[model samples]
Target: MKLSKGANAPVPTSLLAVVVSWRSEHAVDAHALLLEGSGTVRSDRDLVFYNAPRHVSQAVTLDQEPAPRTARLSVSLPRTEADVDRIVVAGSVENGTFGDITGLTLTVHAVDGAVATFEIEDADAVRALMFGEFYRRDGRWRFRAVGQGWASGLAGLVTEFGVQVDDPADPARTTHPTDPFRLHRSARTSPSQEVRSARSATGAQPDPAPPGLRDRHDLAPVRHFPHGSFASDPPRRSAQSAREDGATGLTSDDVVVQRFSSSDDDADGRTGQEAAHNRSDASASVRPRTDLLDRAETAATLGSYRPVDLTRHTSETAPAAPPPPPNPDLADWHSDPEAPERLRWWDGTEWTSATCQHHPPSNRHCARCGHPLRRKLLGGLAPCQRCELEIEEYLTHWHTQAWRVLTTHGPRGPVWAALWASLRYQRIDADAGRRALRAVALSYVERLVTFTFADGEVQHAELELFEQAVTELALGGPLIEDLRRRMHRGRTLSRLRAGDLPVVRTPGLHLDPEEKVHVDLPATHVRQLARGPKLTEGRLIGSNKKLRFVGAGAGTEMPWSRIISVHAEQETVVIAATSSRGGGTFAVADPDYVAAALEGALRVAKRLVLTPGQRDTRSIPQEVKAEVWQRDGGKCVECGDGHYLEFDHVIPLSRGGATSATNLQILCRSCNRAKGARI
Candidate 1:
């Protein structure tokens, strides 16, 4: 079994061998500290090392010998004192830091020959590391992979756990290493070092090999609990008891160390050793016959959890809580620090079935509606669940996201120019920015090209893969088009953006000068305003100046000023105009966008009347920008990207939208430019 850092598995038995191996020319000393329940050692007597290789209780022993690159320790848990709850395994190198040595590994071999291994992946420049521990939890002993290090070496490590450091009385002690984990040794100090037969003549390792060392070898994957799973197992039976019970060749080590998710209080309000005993009897009654298969268990016993390894980022306002004890505060919900996107409810004393959808997948949050996606809606350019209107419908949502991204990435200008500025910001020279953007673009293209499967329908995952891709790469145009088509949903995103605008021209329409079309919903059906029962098949055509429903006959057209507010339904829009006007209820393909387009066109008509010569000015009020920044979480409104931000007028100002906070939304240059990409 391979254990990841911070992961734990129960040891079937206490009598086990732990070996620390690394490929280094320098000798690395291994030490074990027997810790009490209070987390401190009883005294220097509990320390096991080269000089003091055996514990007073006869429960633990340092092998004092190694197989080439490995050091071993034998632990007999049954012989350990009840007061001693944990055995901490640690190692150190006095010659240099662990970073200088590679391939550091810890292997635990149980009496049943079950093996669990952990490799320290991130070896820092620290002198010592608390590799892991075999600790008692609810009467069960489990092994945890703890790769924490100490920069101050073993002295600081021992002192932290209440060990006193004193100068040795013997003169040779002065020459010997003082750090508990790093017992100093050298060939120059020993007179017979040359003829010591390759043994650690420095006395760290025994010259003669230890017994039982020859039996250890590669073993099969132990039939154990699954990773990050909860299991049910009783208090471990002794090796003698298992043999007498005739349960195959299983020993006390044959039992798996298991953890429960809840307290006994949730049952009959039990506590202390009484709680443990009662639970043991209760679980033993349900324990299945293991003799049915000595090699593997038919199924996993069900129950709960173990130690938590939390690594998550919390909101800026409230820092994450420290790793809590087995039971902290009783009630309410707390973040699952390991899985950031989940909330685990603490029902006063134990975990309950209470849960809710947790935080979003990204670190960013949306400003206007407090969406977890920040400006990016559902990891796409689509409208947020709350704010369903397109950019043109509402214009007060982009300032803060824009300013933040703009300043960090250089400046906000044209869509592609802004992203270029952000990507190339602070580059060494003029060509640096271009090279950087091209690199990103190439990487994006490369990923899609490598995936051979190209079914016509695009999966959400595929679209998200290129949701932030640089769409304007001239050299990648042809391939990007093919990839875009493969990933696009129903229609191209460029069409969606165009559909959100204040104008969408129908191909065959002959329009008058300045009579711009805003929206065109095809395959639409209509009903008359005069309470006519018959339905008419038509296309709903919306322009900046009017709303028209064209069918087989002369189409009905009404000026925007005469129409009342548009009501949007699932797949239809209700256009209520004056009794004399031609507007009517129309069933359309996308009523939301159609309704929003009509509303936008009406606003444009009103704006044109109010300011006939008004031109688009790319400026937002500072106060409004500040409010927008706070609301949109200071990131792009479409996607929470914080670089090269531009205040994307959801509805452009040229279409008669106001420069208001409600209409402002920040979008990164990449997202803003991706609006026109085919995908």
Candidate 2:
């Protein structure tokens, strides 16, 4: 297998794309490129030579020798100097070959007998051909999986190498593995302390703190920076007088960071045989810049492992502390008003509980909690500890409307179908959306339903859906009364199909009017309705007493106004709205939408009552104020101010906040903070 060219050899102006076909069972087929030269190839036959140097080599390596195989060839015409600079060799598992590629290695030799070898992963060896140096060592090769650094080599070759192997493999070829290249070591003048900031505060860098320095909780010991105390220090380069003379320029913590390496053939190393197996530690040189072991160790620490304290000198490290208890404030935000607690905040660099003196302490209350005093106690998103009963209730309501429109009329079930189509374009997958607790199909419908609500103008025809749905409800009958003015009447650019149901929006809405009006809406309330030419796959439902609409097309009949008070109690939200003309009470399912709608309706009410005369009239009877106070549990909404309170509309009535007890709230002096009279 001595493939070579001499001093008088023709300069290859094009690259040779080689593809080997083989079969294997027990052993995987592999290949490697051992040379670089310019030439062009086409399939298993055509070959064209051009004017370029050489610069490509790849190997299809295997656990055992490759099975009987044929090589396919292709040529890439030279375009720049890189094409003439080096050579390239690529390997592949021949067509109809058997078994997987278990391992691979490549070896390249120059005219002057300069040889370079590399053991690469079976799949990536040939791809690694882009890097000129490719060779095998000792006849045995160990393949390793690719990591982040491999992508760097690809960029360098295409941009820096100028040589492009344009003939990519056919449909079935496997992807290339990463190439592991050695990074040149940086020069060290004199070693300095690598200290954590805590020790840096003092005048000088503190000596390396021994391991277990803060072992006991009661010890209250201090730790200095430059942690490698046990390691030896580098020699100083001083020349002047004793004090100003030949002063050892090296600081007390100055130490030459060195790595211990063992020769490949050496059997006298600390871990001897075990160390020999790892190629990274097989460097013979002790030179600070030439040692691969040191580079490998540094890379290993930064690339994969967490920062570790390796100093063997024992001084007793502090015991890890138990996590803090969950904050009660966050419990109210979750579906369940009374869920178990979780861990609180930790501002440490690595959750080590070691605080930085310069940084402010984390707030005690949970950050995500609506309670100004409470925060999201846990680190990130905690698992679903509470039941999704509220979400399910909302979904139930959405489902009723979804099922009605999906099964009832039109050519394409309901709005859910269009939504699924839009989500597909958004690149949203079921797994990702579900993880975020979003229903893809439902989101499509909701977007179409609410686009024109908050914003004054409707940007698209979808606004008609929200307008139509809202019209069926009595409370804000005039809210969406002008459907034509809000929407652009465009052609049917998109429609939901029957088979596309899985990808389309599914609507759900729940209406409970017992103690209070509770509106439960499906979680898919946010995805876009349509994108480019695709319709999104989710829907939203606005549930008021009179109307329960799904998408822009469907609705469910419910006595929503007959609702009384709606509040979260434990796992369920109770709604106490009256039915049969305020005679008997109907305790329907949970309604999450009611709160949000109340917020929306209040905004409308506030706008309605914003007249100058309305401000001084004091139309809110004293009796109404008393009821509102009791409903709020006599708590302030601002500053947490408790006394000298007044009745305020949660959603100001002028903006559509109702005169109902549920819409009004009690606010103390501090609670009203800057909430001036809007009317």
Candidate 3:
């Protein structure tokens, strides 16, 4: 519908299109100012859109429609943006007043069709014209033909809308040439004049000047004087007249004035001497003081003096203050008065009714073997240094033996070893722990080993008989009934070895069942040592006093009396012995177990004596064997056979050669015999 000035129409949709067509005689620019619900612009929300240096909004955008005399503004109506509530469409003449524009029309269209239109006919003296506005009322939108005009141009409208205008003449005022929204001071008025005009427009009176200060416009003009210019010369008088006046002591009005001029000079050019003579004459005119005694008497009469007493004052001394008493509430642990050997606990505010008997401090020693603990084991209840190294060697041997038994004799060997060690060291009920071990071993066999129909699936009775046989061979059970009861549960052996499942403890195993066991057998010891990622899982088993390690796909063993030196290296323990050619090194997961085992092994090894034959036997140690095996790739060096290995002396013992690792090498039995025959 065509809308004239002051006309209005209801808008249906949130999205609306505004088209402005103006046929102006001069260049004119169309613009719009987005305002809030207050019908006013705020610094944070107000946005100005113009032709040059165009401004775009997320909710309202200017379309690139190809209409020569037209500008299109697309408004997104259903806007969640809380800041924009109204859009004011306006136009301004670039170089001429709005009166110079002929036909100016602004039309708003909804999706259906034309919603409203504003037309301006006479805009004389107006440089900016607000054509129409689209605003929100309640929950609905409406369009109004405002047709408001400002004679002071777009800048005036911008200032009226609360934008600050910078003085155009201010050199310090920064403005971007392409910024159309920047308001510039009007050329007709300076900043001060504009301020005055604003005050006048607001009906605010200027403050009155302070009293006695003339008005700025009413002040007299100051006169300027050139250099060496004089308004009038001083009143001329003769020096003789001045001297006569001085002799007569003339009155102030009759006194002669002497003038000194820069131009004064004698004909003989003696200006300096003349100046000196004049100064002397001036000095001679002053009267001299003749009464010295009279001057002294006058000074004495003017001066006042008084005598002060020179004696000291006396006063009595004050008494000293008393010291503070000791605190009664403070408490500390002290020897018991009744029993000097006992200590009594004392709470800070008062003493508690608790007393503890003190035990004499003993030299730290291995709890298991009673070997004197070294400085390295002094931290806690760790075993002596020897035990630590022995434990590592024992663990290595146990892991290898366990894996070998598991692969060769079936899981029964390792499972029996684990169960027996658990019973002996963990102090668990023999019958119950055996039952748990049997169940675990059965699970392990089922999971790891597959039996075929041809392999002879045994009946329950036969299976029980087989279990009895394994138990008798690996773990000595007294009778069949005891073996049956012990190996009946059929549980997984891995979980039992891992200690995730606990076995029933023997009754009266300790005074407190909850108390931790100080000494553990090889199985529990290795399990404790294999606690970290470096050592995944290991079992230490001891049979006939020989420790073996079974895990990590390798086995290691060392007699209890063979460890010479046991010490820790980073996270591992290294074991060296008088009998071994090289030391044994194993990763340490549980330092306590390593220390305990090493100390015990060392104590045993130190006390035990070997027969002269055993001691002097010219045999290569396991460490040297390992080195030779690796060096020879587990093959005979002479014949290159990978089996029937024998460590032969490179130089025969009869040839005065030392039985050392340097003289040792691996050879097949045939090669060794041939070499012996040749020697």
Measured on C-alpha atoms, candidate 1 has an lDDT of 0.50
TM-score, cand. 2: 0.18
- Residue lDDT tens for model 2, 1-679: 2222211122222333333333332322222222223322111101111111121211122222223443332333332211122223332222222223333333332334413333343333222223122222222221211211122323222323222233333454322211011122232311122223335655554433322211122222222221111123223321112112212111111112111111211222211111111011102111112222223323322221111121122236544544322332111111111212322112111121111111122354222211123224775443221113222332333334433332222113112332222222111233432333223223333323322222122222334444433332211323233333323321111110000011112233233542222233442212223563322222223222242324344323334444444333222323334542322211223322233343233223233213211222224544565465445554565555543455555675446766556666656534543564343
Ranking of predictions according to TM-score? 1, 3, 2
Q: For residues 418-467, write the lDDT of model 3, one tens digit per residue.
A: 32332222112345443434433442333121121011122233354446
What RMSD does model 1 have? 29.9
How close is every model to the real structure, measured as TM-score? Answer: 0.26, 0.18, 0.26
After superposition, the stretches of candidate 1 with alpha carbons farther than 4 Å from their true spots are 168-679
Looking at candidate 3, what is the lDDT of residue 109?
Answer: 80
Write down the RMSD of all candidates, one decimal each.
29.9, 28.3, 48.3
C-alpha lDDT values of all predictions? 0.50, 0.27, 0.43
Candidate 1 lDDT, tens digit per residue, 1-679? Answer: 8999999998865689999988768678788888877888765556676546777566788887678888888989767765678999988777789888888999999877756899997878999888999998655678999998899887667667766554334343322211111111232433223214334544544322111011123111122211111235534443234223322111111111101111211232211111111122222222322221111111111001121111112366344454643544223345654544444444322443322234344445432223444355556544343322311111111222222333332121122232232211111122433343353445334433222121112234335535434334433556566555545532232223223363454778978777777677674555554677557777777787777778878577878778866756445777777864465667777665566567656656665322211212444544666566667765677776654455555665546666777876666657766652122
Report the C-alpha displacement of residue 291, candidate 3, in angstroms: 84
Better by lDDT, candidate 2 or 1: 1
Q: Predicted candidate 3: what Cα RMSD to the true structure?
A: 48.3
Model 3 TM-score relative to the real fold: 0.26
Model 1 worst lDDT run, 10 consecutive residues: 295-304
